[model samples]
Target: METSDQNAAVDALKDPEAFSVIIDRYRYQLSRYIQRLGAFDSDTTKDLLQESFIKVYLNLNDYKPSLSFSSWIYRITHNEVMMHFRYMRNRAQAFASEDALTLFESIPDELDIAVESDARLRSMHIAKALQRLKPEYREILVLRFFEGKSYDEISDILEMAPGTVATYIARGKMALGKVLQEMNITSV
Candidate 1:
């Protein structure tokens, strides 16, 4: 059986238009991932997305189908996002974007709230709590929970060992739980 994106990568190499298919498949996911990494502005996020796709396309041959394609692409995206942070680090402004809240919106509410009037408020609180996390902790949480990547997949994406990924997820969950607790938000 072909790896998830292996065939697409092959076709993309032969036809430039085929690359668009891959872009369409991953654009939203990559956009969200980029935002999670600290990009908030549409312009900067768009630029990084384009740059990431270009890099992926150019490096298609280097991709090993034996590995998870999702991880490989995320690695590229992660690198681009990190570069953005490095560039913006000197500007003295923290990345505080409401776009991150949209990620929570994608998650289905466990129960319809007929009584609680503060669902949005709670979401904002969670978003702020997430932002308070160190980038590594936040990234691991996002990948494991939001992106739904397996430990080995996250390992490949972050270029760490699987054991390292597990350790990060464990520690990240604890850190996130602590932050939520500080905000009086019950752990879900």
Candidate 2:
């Protein structure tokens, strides 16, 4: 079977219809990322997705095929989320949506089946820890672990050096551990 063009940006620019393919590929994942990062309402999330896609379309010429297309789209979505965060800066803490919780559960873990019943508790602990983190740390960890992006991909998405991405992940994990410890979430 023939493969689709890997340079989606160029294809999308030349044929506007091709942009929908990018949207179709990224919309759901992008929505999940926005929800996890900012916990925006559905209306707001939809609006952000629209705006982000529009920007992606407009900026197609700027994309470089040397980088992963996934990373480029994620970087756009990440900026949109941060822009919304700035707009809603006065708001209080936003809880994770059910979808976010489901996504977290979908990731494989090393815990034994005996701990299956305790998953809810662990999820809550993690959610709280994530909320306590600074946006930079939280975002880096989310992109790496939740979205399954590599350090190089994250560096592309976040526009940081690879070493900086590693540092943030390490620091984010330490911060998460500290938060969990304070909440008495010690392991057996």
State residue 182's C-alpha deviation in candidate 2, in Å. Answer: 1.7
RMSD of each: 4.3, 3.2
**lDDT values, one for every candidate:** 0.74, 0.74
lDDT of 2 at 92: 21
Best by TM-score: 2
**Worst ten-residue run, lDDT, model 2?**
107-116
Tell me each candidate's TM-score.
0.83, 0.85
The positional error of residue 123 in candidate 1, measured at the CA in angstroms, is 2.6
Kindly list the per-residue Cα lDDT of model 2 for residues 74-180, writing each as its tens digit. Answer: 99888977887888773225665454465455432421111224656655556666778889988987788788888899999999999999988888877766766
Clash pairs detected, candidate 1: none
lDDT of 1 by residue, 116-175 (tens): 235565556556666788888888877877777888889889989989888887787777
Off by over 4 Å in 2: 1-7, 90-92, 106-117
